[model samples]
Target: MDFALVGLIASLILLMVLALKGMDLLIAAPICALVVALSNGLPIFATQEQGDIANYSDSYLGGFSQFLKVWFLVFLTGALYGKLMEYSGGAKSIAHWIIEHVGMKRAVTAVVLATGILTYGGVSAFIAAFAVYPLAASLFKQADLPHRFIPAALALGSVTFTMTSAGSMEIQNWLPAPYLGTTPYAAWQVSLFTALAMAAIGIYWLNRMIHTAYQQGERFILPQASIIASVEAEQQQNVNPLTAVLSLLAVFITAFLFHQDYSNNALVIALVAGCVVLVVGYWRQLSQHFTKVGSEGALGALIAGANTSAVVGFGSVVKATPAFAFAVDAVTAIPGSPLVSAAIAVTVIAGITGSASGGQTIALPILGPIYLDAGANPEHLHRTISLSSGVLDSLPHNGYVVTLIRAICGESHQSAYLALAKMTMVVPGICTVLALYFLA
Candidate 1:
């Protein structure tokens, strides 16, 4: 790759490091993007390069706007949906039902699995963690489980929610072509498979950790209320169980219809149906929740999307021009069997976006075409790649991880890293290895 392309790669790494170091994502992303822009000599668009340097600022602004458009509706609707659920007693009601059925012994596991399932319903982990943590914290405390387990449980829950949630309208999942183009229907099937794999692995790991903690009586490591207490008190409600379930069912029905014709947006239809259910079930009560959903959801979604918006935009800009094209080619040029190449592509792309969705966006666009060109099974390759993307996305540096850790645990720096590692490293590793074995 050329020096400029190499610099673009280096800048991306630096951006992650900055995020890990507690830099604001908005600042870090733009700075990193600017660095990439300067390094790659990207001046907004291609036409401007041959023209003048005066258009550099315009390019940056234009790129920023493009990212905003992608993140705005996706994150807004998703976030609002969560907020609405919070206000309407939907999430809590679900958690309460789960606890009532599973009993405290299995509460943590139940919460994680349930969150994963709900994510498939277009729920973001940000909303899931907030919605579930209070209920989970109360149950974990009653069970005399370690306090640390609360945040850990929450982190695990978010991973499943964000990674493979059923009808997710997450920009990374729904809108982005790079992520699903190579796989198509693979999103649905693999989404389910990954949820199961992640849950099994997460359960095994959680049990192992708890067992070890109890055996050693490592009281220091267990979750404390202090970790997630603030979030619980300040929590918002959205949709009740009846609404969430009915809404979700409508989504399933719509999805079936969508299968008959691929042009419809599953998320838009699902959320709309869900909102209808909410309104129908509890008119005035639902109206009260709408404001909470609008404000909180918008804020939360904006927070998450801002970091990614700039990063995705800048990354796309860098990838588009000749300056960073060499880096793109170089990654694909790595020598391996097509299968191995596919796997590497999945892992690499996932790591790039620090998100499963993002990975799909970055890698799938490029990787999908390559895999298709190489004549790989579109379903298998796409599923494999999509699932693998979740691995790195669960890492502490990832936007979702940091957002939940900070929001739930109320800790920063290294406090949540342990919980993050439990989900991101141990859990995802187990799942990924199993997938590799199965796919192999």
Candidate 2:
């Protein structure tokens, strides 16, 4: 038992360390699984049962394959939908329209809201960040706000209020359904309130940060020559805004209408329908690179699916360990409402994993059944779990944060991450507590 505990700790630390260092999760996951298997006294590849238990291959591969079987289509369709939107200029068009109407005075709000629109419309968060950055840069420059705050604005918009909110097309919103037997719209009333509160608080805090920075004599500086040239080239394209609006609306309408009937697969159908709409509505706009776009979408889906599946595989091995059982038992035994307990457990695991969706995928397989058995409301559990996952998963080591801060915006963590923490982690954490109070 002591050895199992040590192994669990070692595996978690190794996983987080490697993931934060930017190692491919596909490589890191299997190695972590090996750590757990060795500590648990499990055979690595024997099909024969040890006593009544299955071998490591069965548990690890079982989790990996199960997630793929149930969710490959959703991942494929979501990624493809995002790619099609990117290729059709729909995403950029939407961002530009929002910025145009919002104007420069409210530049931060404009960027945040624009990102929210694209994210809820099924564009990947990474893609949304890329699509919105140029416009955000321009808007910040016009407003004289510091450029460093751009990541916070983007993270707040894309990952916080919109990503896990009810009716979100993001995978985080869809992942709980299979485990809870609920729709992506589960606990929507509570979800709506929580999302609004998060937005309100986050925006207020974000503006305060910008105001403080402005008072400190910090202001927007011109981007690199290469970045400006790239942004200029992108803006030179001719794309209609109406077509973009309609394409996004197609996704929302289809998903909203069909979600109840199809469950998790509803997202698949909606994404497919949205893709058809984009192709038909923007055929002339998309014709030049349609084949390349499709291929890229497929490749992107593979990468996204593989990353998520690898974590699920790691989770499978962990759950089979005695230490995992002990931890779950300890968590479930916590006094107070089960909702609070669920929130804490999910948040901690998410912090450990550094991926919101990955954390939920892992915690739910074990936590879901236990919470349901304790008579916890599945809707409440689902919503709380979803929101909680977003809270700590935005830690500096989080995949999305790293991507936004370094890769996308080209800013150091030291300069930009505090504001991000306020919007994504601090606000969301408070919202989670409020949600537990109201919904539980």
Candidate 3:
């Protein structure tokens, strides 16, 4: 193996190891990127770089700044909107309604379905996690389910089927379109089948794990320093469940109507609209909390966005390495069916980058034309890579996985990642394989 390849693999391993050990990404990402740069013979500064060789400053900061610029507002307003729902008691109201109608025993399913509804409706998964987690915490506590499973349930709904299914507005699903000359709804029949299978299998796996934990006497255990206030000086004002749902509808409906022309900007608008509805619907409760909500929400937004951006910077450095190019070449050259090769290629790259969309963006441009020239079906290639991108992308170091486990759930990776892996990685891997076989 090339020395650069050795550095790339070692740096990824070190990154994940540090992440599992609870090192902050803002620090760890730069440290790991330095390793990649040193080993790959890239210059530390742009002024020192030779032709076509990316320097650490240019590549790392470029990815970091680019992600933040694109996503920070969405994070800001989404967190603020979620905070409004939490502070106003709207999320709790929805939880109570679900308990009454859906029954407490089905709390896990409720979390999954609620998140799926939001994600499929064009809500950012980060936003969906924020919006649904307060409700999930309430439902899990009421049902006595272990809080550790919360991350998995949220990920299962947000990242698995809903993310990669045909027509999903998620970047992973739609990313292959321009390169493959296919629509977002490419290979609808296979995509739908794979999606449903993934959902059913993942839900079953999650519930089974929760049930087994319950049998072993494990139960809901809220953290001592929980982000949610266990008690408040001002009693939570009662919010009507139906009326509270209007806020969610605002986000979904607005994103649905304006997505084509506005794209991600529509999500920012949708989240702001949701916040507007929440403020109006629960003004009596939220009016006094407004200053606190905005400050806290903005802080949360910075933390989440910065954490994910740190990893994106790491991926950016990895992308610049000769090893990444070599890996892409090696994967695309795999013998046999283009569909299988494409699926494997995307999955491996996604794992390496710890991002589905990142992997697809890198791989499709190279793989698309190769397979197309070999007479591959564009729609099949589109759907296959769509599903494939979601598979290995959930490895422990993934930005979403790290954010979901540590930042959002307040659970350490040690406690939360196993269930997450079973749901997001294993179930999605199985479903993708099934799609490949059927499509083959």
Candidate 4:
């Protein structure tokens, strides 16, 4: 009935059509943005200034610019580091190590756990998935784990939850950049306790799915269970282990350097640092896998990063909602209880976006201000909201889950909803209980 409600509904309908019809986002997003703009009585081409090659973006262009201004460098830096890891066999090495060391049965669990740790350290989810997925799939098959669990582990490990918690080196949390007009550093922080609690929720959810599969007799097949043994049978590569070790350390070193406050541009640091390691340790080996490694790395980035970029763009679009002011107004209306306001605000924004990053885009900008005005620790508020985005966006049907299901197991949308239910409702419930405890 209401105009704002209609625009919102239309936007949602577009997302559904895109999903069901296999429409491209480049087409879907602009079309949807136009609809929202027109429905809200805003001109689609308000940029007719001076008639000089007029630009055609809603006010969202301004928001998008701001989003990019803050995040582009971070993303590029992340991408570069990710690219280097791929070049050095670092990513494959990590994946292989997890499978061989953890074994098939426990590998799924280990990979998921590793993702959480890396995510909490501020790596991008795109990088995490790329780094882990190839190996995780083989691990899944051997453990009799469902192939679908590959994406599940990667997404859960990377995207939602403590992975985005404030103070995490992970880019997802910081993608919101300036929340409520405050710099990212202003958000309070993600406590170790909160992170542990969030991680517990994730582990429990995965285990529950495992039990369900056990009951269902779901088929499990590990395609590369013998990869490591076979490779070793041919003799370890002449490339020294030290080379691989340092290449892997690139990520760890970068995370350590930025641990004090996550302001540094990770891409530049990772690249320069990774390059040095690759040169000194196994520079020659680079040629051995040149074309193959280069392509695989980019493929990883493209697959994971493409979806991420869209969600990033969507955040830009929604931030321009005519009702954005109204949304901010509503968040400000919460009286007396700051904690309740934070919980509700984070949940709504995160749920709507199907992206923890997008939720921060909407919620942090508005709610961050409210909390600051109320004298809440800016960092704390930021961190809590960031953490909130992860839990809220864990819906089974979200892009992350969808990608996981399709990539690993050929699951149709219907089959993956069970994991979504477990994570969205069950995991968040546990996290919420703990959140209240922490706040009190």
Candidate 5:
């Protein structure tokens, strides 16, 4: 038995377990990195090797630093954008406007569309969930829709179609660019079709599930009276819906105009533009909370950036191990289209890691070189891996799923997760398969 391989596998398992147990990734990731280092016989500090030093700190921090170097701005701006939208009453205004226009008859659709718009505009999904939840709850309550389905509607809008689709400002869509030398608009033709498919099928399935639950006599259950009052209080903010729409459009327009010229950096510019729009557009509404919101947004960005960086650090350690090399060899050796192999490898690793970004961070460094050398289309490969990453990464144990269902929505997985799974996992998985068939 290869003890080193065993340690790698063990570390991966522990990472997932710790994450699912609500442990901070900052602590869990480093501990797991130490495990892989010890098992693989790496030096804890530094060692002289062929006129250079080989050390665990270098490898671990190297990956962490590299990710931050490349993505810190994006993360910072994205969080601030989300925060401005939230604190300025812009996000709520948008939600209320959509609900009003769509009407109570299609309350779920309104909530989902609201979330989709925010997420596609580059707001963090977590922030989008929190910002939209109050509106979603009120809508469901008014429509007599089951409250348990709230997470599903939010997750569907935030993660499935808009998140992975071409031209999205999400990091998942942008992460592959530097590695593949492709723009965020990679394979956009196929992405448009796949996104439409996911939207149509996922929305239909989600509505069907809600309708089924309603038919079975399930209806919205009011939360504790205190919780209701808190939610209602949160939803009482007033802001002009038109200004909010323009704030969102500022992000979309800036990104659209600059993406071709600036690539991923366009997102930073776009988010900044959006923030300025919100601040100016809703100055009176946000004046009291401006300082607080900016500080909170910065703090949120730090936490999110650190979490992703920690996992990337773990991947850095994994990359230096013999086990990772062997695994890479095995994956690349699979007999089939390189796109198919890339998709399978990325999706499986994403499922295991419980993070699409983490999985792609680990796999792309190895697969990018191999596939590009094998004459694969860089644009197609980018789209394939991005779409595939979203599929299995939404497993029950995933951090995002847990946060959305339990932490944010205050609902148990037993009731909410079925709808969540259909919209996120199943829908994305089907789209990934179809993407391979059509793009390959």
Candidate 6:
């Protein structure tokens, strides 16, 4: 391997290590980007004397700015939209409804199903986690299942099949459409099978793990008093389940109807419409909490957008290096269907970046033309990249996984990550391979 490539790989590893340590990406990303710049002989900053040289400002910040330019609105509206569903009791309403219908006898199944529904329905995965968790805790306690598996159940629902499925409200599903000139429903036939296989296999594995824990005499542990109190408070605000479902439908139906001409703009419109529905549904309560909701939502959007862009900046710096060109050549030269090469390239970048959107945003710009020029089906590439992005992007460093395990569930990685890995990484990985075979 070339020395620059070695440096690139080492920088990525360092970034992952920093992520696992729970350092803020806003800080970690730039530090690692500097490493890539220095090691690759890129300039630290472009000056008047060296106006055209790739540097941290031109490369890293340029990448970062471009991501925000393109995606800030999506993140902004997505966060506010999720917050509306959350604050107006829409998400909780749906969670309660699912739990009521599914019954507590199958606690693990209920959590997974509820989370999947909320996520697929256009609620942010973070919001869905918060909404369902109170219900999930109560269910697990009542059903006598161990609490450690809650993160896994959430991951299985939020990130695996639901996140990558055709027409999913997830950004991952939408990211490839613009790049490949395909819709989110690209290759619907293969995506349908991939999603079903992922869900069926994941549900089975989650249940089997719970059963084993039961056989070992494991039982649910009580959560903190504050956690219990929050659940009770959440139960107090009971928005109608129908209202909740409508809010979700607004996003999905509008996006589906408009995605062809508007592309990702459809998502922005859909999210705004969803927010409007929730605001109307909960107008009375909005008087009390409207400002707080907007502020919090915007803040959340800022954080999420900045975090993704930081990683994208790192990708930007890496992209300027000769090593990146070399790596791309090697990946594209792989002797197989262009779909196979696309999958490998997308998955590898997603894994390295610890972000699906960040990875696809970086790789697709370069790889999309290559595969399309080679006569690969744009729809196939869209589906392949979408599914592949979900695969290794869930390593322990992934922001969503880290948040779910530690921030939401209050469980350490050592206790919860094994189950999460199985759901997010292993199951999706198997389904991705199956997708490649079918698409091939």
Q: Could you say which candidate leads in lDDT?
A: 6
Off by over 4 Å in 6: 223-237
Q: Write the per-residue lDDT of candidate 3 for residues 301-413, one digit (tens) a residue.
A: 89877876777787788778888778777877888888999999888878866778767765776778998897789999999999998999888877778778877788887
lDDT by residue for model 4 (152-258), tens: 56665666564655455566555545444333343343355655665666766686777688689876543332223232232222333455456546755764565
lDDT of 6 at 404: 85
Q: Pick the candidate with the highest TM-score.
A: 6
Each model's lDDT: 0.61, 0.84, 0.80, 0.57, 0.85, 0.88
By lDDT rank, best first, the candidates go: 6, 5, 2, 3, 1, 4
Each prediction's TM-score versus the true structure: 0.83, 0.93, 0.82, 0.79, 0.93, 0.96
lDDT accuracy of residue 306 in candidate 6: 96
lDDT of 1 by residue, 1-440 (tens): 37676767787688779878778766776677677777766664446346654334555566567667645665666676666666777767776667667887886677775565566666677667776777776666666666566567777766643554334444444433334353134546545666577777777778787777768765433234344444345334444467667765665566546633453245555566666665676566676566666777778878867766655655555555565455557666767545456666656656655656555555656667776787766556655665566666655457766666665655564655675576765676566556555554
- Tens-place lDDT digits, model 5, residues 316-335: 88788787777778888989
Q: Which scores greater on TM-score, model 5 or model 6?
A: 6
- Residues 100-197 of candidate 6 have per-residue lDDT tens digits of 88998877778888999988877889999988988888888778898999989988889888899998989999998888889999999898898899
Worst 10 residues of 2 by lDDT: 223-232
What would you estimate as the lDDT of candidate 1? 0.61
What ranges in model 2 sit over 4 Å off? 1-3, 47-56, 222-233
RMSD per candidate (Å) reads 4.0, 2.3, 3.8, 4.9, 2.3, 1.6
**Which residue pairs collide in model 5, if any?**
none
Task: Tell me which of candidates 1 and 3 scores higher on lDDT.
Answer: 3
Identify the runs in model 3 with alpha carbons over 4 angstroms from their true place: 48-52, 69-77, 121-147, 166-189, 216-237, 263-266, 269-276, 289-302, 361-382, 399-412, 438-440
Counting clashing residue pairs in each candidate, in order, gives 28, 0, 0, 20, 0, 0
Please provide the root mean square deviation of candidate 4 (C-alpha atoms, Å). 4.9
